[model samples]
Target: MTTHERSKAPAVDGAVLIIDLLASSAFPLTLSEICEKTGLPAASGHRIINALLEHQMVALNTSRKKSYCIGAKIFQVASTIYSKQSIIPFFYPIAEILKNEIHRPIFLSVPIGNTVVVVSKLESSLNATFNLHIGQTMPLHSSASGKAILSMFNAKEQLNYLAGQKKTSSHFSELLPKIKADLERAKRLGYAVSQGDIGQYVSCIAAPILNLRNEPIAAISTAVSNEFLTHQEARDFSKKLIQAARQLSSRIV
Candidate 1:
């Protein structure tokens, strides 16, 4: 064995291999699949996975039989890394300006694995029943912020995220086809819209903040009471959001 290989702890290496495998997969994998893919012995793989499960490093996919995916702890760590990026520090001032101009609650969200998590919000004067807080998770294919981010992903990446949904409800599962269609439209329009996809009587319009490579690093969105925003008002909000996104993207190196 090479020096690095000789120094490795077998159990730790196995655990890491399993983690890497799970991280790379779009959908969850069964224990047998994990072992088969990682070349780990069945017994060792099971034990390592159980240990990861106990520590919240891996989670069971209840939607799929005996399958596993990266857990909440991984997402937490990813969010921490995202918070330290240069883009995050620059977000608040831009979002604040957008919120003032639009007169709606503004949200900043970053992708944490396959989902988007809200990292900041600028509260609006309107007493809208719905409010998004920092650390709140949103569906990749549903919410405006999520959709905006998704729109920037390549087709395969977008489909992988969509296919990996936990399918919390049959209604959401049934909407997958439509959601895919909406993502395409979002790509063309340079923004995304959500009508009650998250909260009752709530609507959001969002645009993706891209990095130098033109990949979406995050999204900025405005939420308003659907009851109050007219079609023309929503259109105005979308234009403002797209502009803010472009401004923010320019700052990203």
Candidate 2:
């Protein structure tokens, strides 16, 4: 890539370089070695490494003091991409069922790093429906589906994710506590709610699909226009959403 293009995409370029280097290597690399190989400055490599580590795309070998290697997330993604019928087939029908019941745009999503990616969606037919497409991603703190998945993360994972965010998030400390409270409430209610955080004039209700061990592997959500969402009605929809999520979780695990 040209210098100007690379400058415009520093984060993407640095991340791609680090992943390519680690994937091609037989052994883990030290922080200095990665910087040398990528020709990235020490500080630049450090920032890239922290971001990758938060996603579990790379893991630190603490025993070796700063050595890094591909983490389990790589394998998880590989299996999903390479394998046929990787959970989507089983989940979409459930999303359809929920949409028919709620008459809203239902979505299936999986948490990847600090965000959630839409894997499947059943679009609504209403004239004023909200829109969501498969493969779209949203930040964990901003979307209902994202927070539903985040509510299931352990304390350590949550801390690691928040700590790795880009430097532009100067007020993240002030924001994290509110997100934490939302997750805690979601955990108790078995669903999460978000108002226009991910979409303008849109409200969403989401619930986590749990694995056998009760960990959230993914989530299901319904996004609707704010005009249709009344206070009591939102809670009722949340309960129904949780019920649908639990049903899907059982079939998947």
Candidate 3:
């Protein structure tokens, strides 16, 4: 078999080189410092930095106005990487066990902006009307998995997320009170339940998978028929889900 040479782009290479320099620096680097270290032309470096800033790959330091550092987007990407690599591997067996016990579809999700994206899913054999797949994004206030993750956030963080929701959701103002109530109940119960909030004739129960700092890094949820959404059964499912979430979280490190 013949091996193929890799393609390269000078502009992309320079951007990566600039990111590396910023990442290795003890402090934010000024534009001149970045150009000097990367050996790129000043104009080209400035354009690259501006592009990075636009995409939130890099950010201006608040204290040092002209200096730049890594941005929140990079850390968000890194967290997703960490979750997929370190955490998801430990989730399958636990999810499989939960799926078997509850006879419902199980999903594993991680936060992205104000939403949660499904990273893994194990479907149930039962003919349930509800369905979810990998890469599907769910609203934080409407879905069990999203609520589970949100419930773990502090009041300030929760408020920030909800505030951002106003920009995209038309009924956000009206839904605010109910969403807050749901979050409080989720926090109190150590799990969240969405009764027909995600779809008709289906309900979901989820629990947050926390990191070492007790912050939610991911959530595990099971989607079941509305028939099982009754008080006693919902509590039962929540108890099992919370246990599985804790078990998976314990093995994350």
User: Residue-wise lDDT of candidate 3 within 1-253, one digit each (tens)?
Assistant: 0112213666787788888888879999999999888788999999999999999999999889799999989999978765555678888899999988888888898888888988888888875646677767778888999999999999899988998998767889998998999999999999998877667888888999998889998999988778656889889989899999999989866
- Give the TM-scores of the predictions, in the order they appear: 0.65, 0.67, 0.66
Q: Largest lDDT belongs to which candidate? A: 3
Ranking by lDDT: 3, 1, 2
Assess the local accuracy of residue 49 in candidate 3 as a C-alpha lDDT between 0 and 100: 92
Model 2 error, position 161 (Å): 2.1
Clashes of 2: 0
> What alpha-carbon RMSD in Å does predicted model 3 have with respect to the real structure?
13.7
Misplaced by over 4 Å in model 2 are 1-85, 127-129, 166-168
Best by TM-score: 2
Minimal lDDT window, size 10, model 3: 1-10
By TM-score: ranked, best first: 2, 3, 1
* RMSD each, Å: 11.5, 11.3, 13.7
Model 1 spans > 4 angstroms off: 1-82, 166-173
Q: Candidate 3: where is the Cα deviation over 4 Å? A: 1-85, 127-129
Cα distance off (Å), candidate 1, residue 76: 11
